[model samples]
Target: MALNKKPVKGMKDILPEEMQIRDYAISVIKETYGKFGFTSIETPCAESIANLTSKQGGDNEKLLFKVLKRGEKLDVAGAASEEDVVDFGLRYDLTVPLVRYYSAHSAQLPSPFKALQIGNVWRADNPQRGRYRQFMQCDIDILGEASNLAEIELILATTTTLGKLGFKGFEIRINDRRLLKAMAAYSGFPEEAYDSVFITLDKMDKIGPEGVKTELLENGFGESCVERYLELYQGLEKAEDGVAYLADMLKGVAETSVTDNLREIIDSVQATKTAGFEMVFDATLVRGMSYYTGTIFEIAIPEFGGSCGGGGRYDAMVGKFTGKEVPACGFSIGFERIIMLLLENGFQIPDRPKKIACLVEKGVEGQALCDVIAKAQAMRETGSQVLVVRMNKNKKFQKEQLMAEGYAEFEEFYKEGLRN
Candidate 1:
């Protein structure tokens, strides 16, 4: 039997070219997020099954890759259910681990701790372009800050990072979970039915308003409720200021402070943002996470034709772990999708160090080899990217490959050069 060399399904082997771009993007994320006072943190990729299944991860929980018990603990024959065998699972996102981290380490961390987390997450789902079962996630979160300042800083920092990566004219579609509940309540929906109603509303972009109406009605909601529910959406489209209009419409139904905080976030980001993007008030934006207790937002890039990343305030998640609720908000950038877009758009790393290659003939050895090594080290010390390799028999092909890897200059060292 032959051993398989290929990676598992939905996983990929990253080549040097893509890795280069990924590394550059990571550097940018760390640098930009650090400027905003976010300290880098790390959590393990594997989390306890209990934490992964805590229902805070939204749809991702369904995609968890559960790890079975090992060796003597396996008990396969006696296992009657998955829970009987599985003890841990690969994390589907970073937020759950982050919360656990905070719950465990809050004593040592500062108040209003700002965190920058970047790591690989796994989801056992079908793979597609710009998505994989295993991929990197980049997140910046603020914990212990109850003010709208958290949301504002997250928006500014995330957009600034995107802008630095050459993303322009993107839309940060913002919404509040409270607003969704208020609108539903004002439309006569039962408080308990908000989740079901939101499930349909989330399909608005894909199914349109009429489709949402049809689904809501088919789901046993009253027609009057559906009619009044969609009317808010129609009015928002025609209003010059969607956020203001919604604020006025839901004045009594939703807390004035909820919409007020939302408006402030939009206004603040617009006033002080360095990125070229629109901060849109999307009434129908239903982030699927059930744990979102307040504002929710997503990043939509015209180039991707879909959401590139999103997050919201999950104020209750930590409480589930420690019995103490802390105000928290996070923004995650789809690292793989961002890389895909950059690769497709031929994005280059700005101000990259000079890349040069030294191809030495195979026969060149002894003091000559030492000279080549010394020269390469010197070039590297001066902040240049240097590649030294033996000359290939197919030298032209090797040079072409090197050129593709961004080697702009090449030096050929021959045996005669040693004599010289």
Candidate 2:
């Protein structure tokens, strides 16, 4: 009989404190990305179910929040399948919608467009720490650029933005889908089994190398293939240059261009990065996107002990929309997770405007109130945050609440005069 006060399962209501941090993070992201020539764009939250389930989003397609047909279109009772009932779904990530956006607007857009998008995405996922069914994603993508320049600029821009936000000593773990496939092929795995193999491989951090080996073998892969595949990882741990080693090891099995491109991206980012971070060649990094045709990467924060954000080359995605190929690469910041870490570590916004609270007693007359308001307005014009409110019966408690909201200086105006 009572209305539910709680949010739906897996979603959250952001409070003022968290909202402050979220706002600041978004500003820094937008400002930093804007300097890199990424023009901001927007796309609708809901997308056609057909496009969302086009098999490009990998496992994320399974987590889509499907939207049912409308009144006239609704035939749920007579529907034979989900397709007959659902027509659209809330987008699970920005990339899919972005590709669709580009497809429709390419004629009006510039060549090699650098686009920046920040928005909420929904997934019917099991909520956990640092994860929610609805969360914000900050993505910057370069379309129509085939060379590794796109990768270099993305890594640089993302890392620089992180640095500006006071993130230090994070790792940008880079890999290539081609390299993943090459390693598997060199180990005698069939092309068809690459996806399943990489699915297990993506858990290397949790399951460890031995765990990955066991899972691979248990999945009916050849024991020799498993050993040979994992040996590459072991070799990487010892090799001075993992990319070079892979380039030579998988030379005949895979294209030399894959390794060369990956190597170029790593070398270029390392040479030009402005952030206090490392550009690592992580052989185990298998970003969970079926559309990623080339280099894949993730942001690894030491404090979080997991990926904070990541993106990769999805050269084939736009082709799906237009039937013509276009080279595209993107990087997305793990916005919610980063905010969680910042909140957990008590990250305060630097250089915040001075906060002053103007508390007027209840009996303060019309002229007195106008004078107090005028004074607060003057303070606001001078770049201060002024909160003018009627003084409560318990002034101390009111001030305490204001203090918690970052209001430090207080001015109490009584009908008679200013109170100390």
Tell me the TM-score of each prediction against the true structure.
0.97, 0.97
Summing lDDT over every window of 10 consecutive residues in candidate 2, give the lowest-scoring window: 411-420
Q: Check candidate 1 and list the clashing pairs.
A: none
Tens-digit lDDT track of model 1 for 176-266: 9988989999999999998999999999999999999999999999999999999999999999998889889988888889988998999
Off by over 4 Å in 1: 417-420
Give me the displacement of residue 10 in model 2, in angstroms: 0.9
Count of clashing residue pairs in every prediction:
0, 0
Runs of candidate 2 with Cα error greater than 4 angstroms are 417-420
Residues 1-420, candidate 2, lDDT per residue (tens digit)? Answer: 999999999999999999999999999999999999999999999999999999999889999899999998999789999899999999999999999999999999999999999999998888999899999999999998989999999999999999998999999999988888889888989999999999999898898988998899889998889998888888889899988998888878878888888888888888888889998889988988899998999999999888899999998889999999999999999999999999999999999999999988888878878899999999999999999899998999999999999999999888786556
For model 1 the TM-score comes to 0.97
